[model samples]
Target: MLRALGLAVLLAATTIAAAPSASAVTRTAVGGGTGIIFRLKPTPETPTSYYICTLTAVGRDSAGNLVGLTNAHCFIDEQGNKLVGERVYRDTSPAGTAFSPAPIADSRPDLETGAIGTVTYVSTPNNLLNSGPKGLDYAVIKLDESRVAPTSTVGQVTITSIGAPPANGTRMCKEGHRTGLTCGKKLGTNGIWFTHLIWTDGGDSGSPVVSGQTLVGNAWGAQHSSPILSIIDAMNTQGGVGAGFHLAT
Candidate 1:
């Protein structure tokens, strides 16, 4: 089995590298309630390296293309470099045996349901140092609708609306492929740096953070993020209007 603590440390130390651009394609947007764990494999290398992360948010860009959200660190490696044309795969079974041909009960990403996503947008690590810090540590992945099931279809979960940023002691919860339905009180201001007092481990990165039914933020390193609105604003300014990505409702 993979060690969460070790993997967590490696993720923190890794940085992203530039990837060759691919022809732009329209992605099918998905709504919240998608808590599938997926694997990311960097390409053009002889030996493949894999990282596990969760799908936090799903939606379409301005052009009505489907997209998903995750953490930028998922695309980074210990070498402090990023991979170009990275491919994402859905976990067809339990976290420990996702690649196995055998199946488990309630195991997702089976023949009928699986998702393939390509890394699209990721927040710059420099945000922590920039004069105007945005507290962003997120990424967006464009999904292939034909292969992946929407959140509404797989589970009745949906991120209908985005709630205000979290404040200290605010109650929040997260759904992850590795750990399902863990909730706790937040530890910081709603619009500032905040960490939930929830239980989170390595693969939980990219899981959605929520307060009640409202969307809050995607999991950072393990359980952290800038304000939820701050991340959205960064996407607007950096991702531009064409990205057209937003929380549902």
Candidate 2:
């Protein structure tokens, strides 16, 4: 349960779903504000831990792969380390029609539960801190099209456009899996980070921050004082897997 308040978790983590049944008909709905959890074993003696976070967005990469966005911390280990090929699972919670991951200390992950995606790209901790004031704290997950029906809307919030961060005092809302939908006015933007009056919870990392249909940033912390990561700056600066990412149509 890392609160994910840190813009960059310590050093660098250079490391680095769910399917529906046929009878169920509808596939798992994965998009912005989706609750997701990933496991970390760390070592053989240590018990595996399930950490939860929110998915920011779902879209296609420049290479045409179905990809999703979230805070890089969601994919990292206890020490905040990440592995490139690490797997990701969904935490549909109690509201959705899917398996909810119950963390068992030493029990193996429910391999029966399908993985939604694998980590394709991450803005490493070293890179985040060194990348300047607004260091990117995001990760891109290459999703499985068969397991999910990707959409840009989360609940009542629909992300129809991607644009620059809104001006100071502009209204902003975030659709998060943990906290649901909460909104406030943008406090201000400094460098690559923007402060907001929004309230968030521990598992709300990577929640999409939007102004109307335009997505402006990603929730980066649990408190209102924590700055939001600018999505446009992150993508433009990183310029690789997540480059030119747009909301799924």
Candidate 3:
């Protein structure tokens, strides 16, 4: 829903039952900085739609379910609506597949990596909550054990723990799928965003905002960020899909 976000689309409602992905490789790491796919089908007989976004962090919930984080916008539509049955896949695009108006001709349903997670909890313009992204826009993804090898590192940045929002003038960095690794100073405010000046773009949604090894903020759009520490508190308070989350190390 933000200006810097990209939307990857592939709609094939006619395809019944996705075949098992023979090409679905076991990802050594599906934590922060990884590229992921979100798929949705209006009905069993309708076409499935897929979108692309970046994974922020992966670990487990209080229930011990393997889970990850990203922006809720990735699973929502232009009208600020969420697809009821969105499923997540490991995006294998070498160049990154940020969403645009038209579906990428090659961006077919990539069951190749299999479905790794489903959106367990989310916050978007359509469904903002007391624990939602109004304070920090984010989504909680429950990862499938079969499709991922969990780790805490986002690219080269190791997320050892959650941290407070960086001071306005503090230094920060992010590992985005589209922008790769970029760093800048904590700049703006007046909004829930940490407001870093780092280089961000579409498809970089949910990229990890880190201060050294401490996970701090989450990239909201191309230019805005939200506090990961705040999101964790919100998720736990919601007592839903991602309640009681812990970062995997």
Candidate with top TM-score is 3
Error of 3 at 237 (Å): 1.2
TM-score of 1: 0.68
Q: lDDT tens digits, residues 93-120, model 1?
A: 4443112312223233322233366776
lDDT winner, 1 or 3: 3
lDDT for each residue of candidate 2 in 181-225, tens digit (9 for 90 to 100): 888888875445677888776667788888897777788763332
lDDT of each: 0.54, 0.63, 0.69
Please give the ranking of all candidate structures by lDDT, highest first, separated by commas.
3, 2, 1
The lowest-lDDT stretch of 10 consecutive residues in candidate 3 is 97-106
With a 3 Å backbone cut-off (N, CA, C), the pairs that clash in candidate 2 are 15-82, 15-83, 15-84, 16-82, 16-83, 16-84, 17-116
RMSD of 3: 4.9
**lDDT for residue 166 in candidate 3, whole number 0-100:** 71
**Model 3, 76: alpha-carbon shift in Å?**
1.3
Q: Which candidate is the best by lDDT?
A: 3
Candidate 1 overall lDDT versus native: 0.54
Candidate 2 achieves a global lDDT of: 0.63
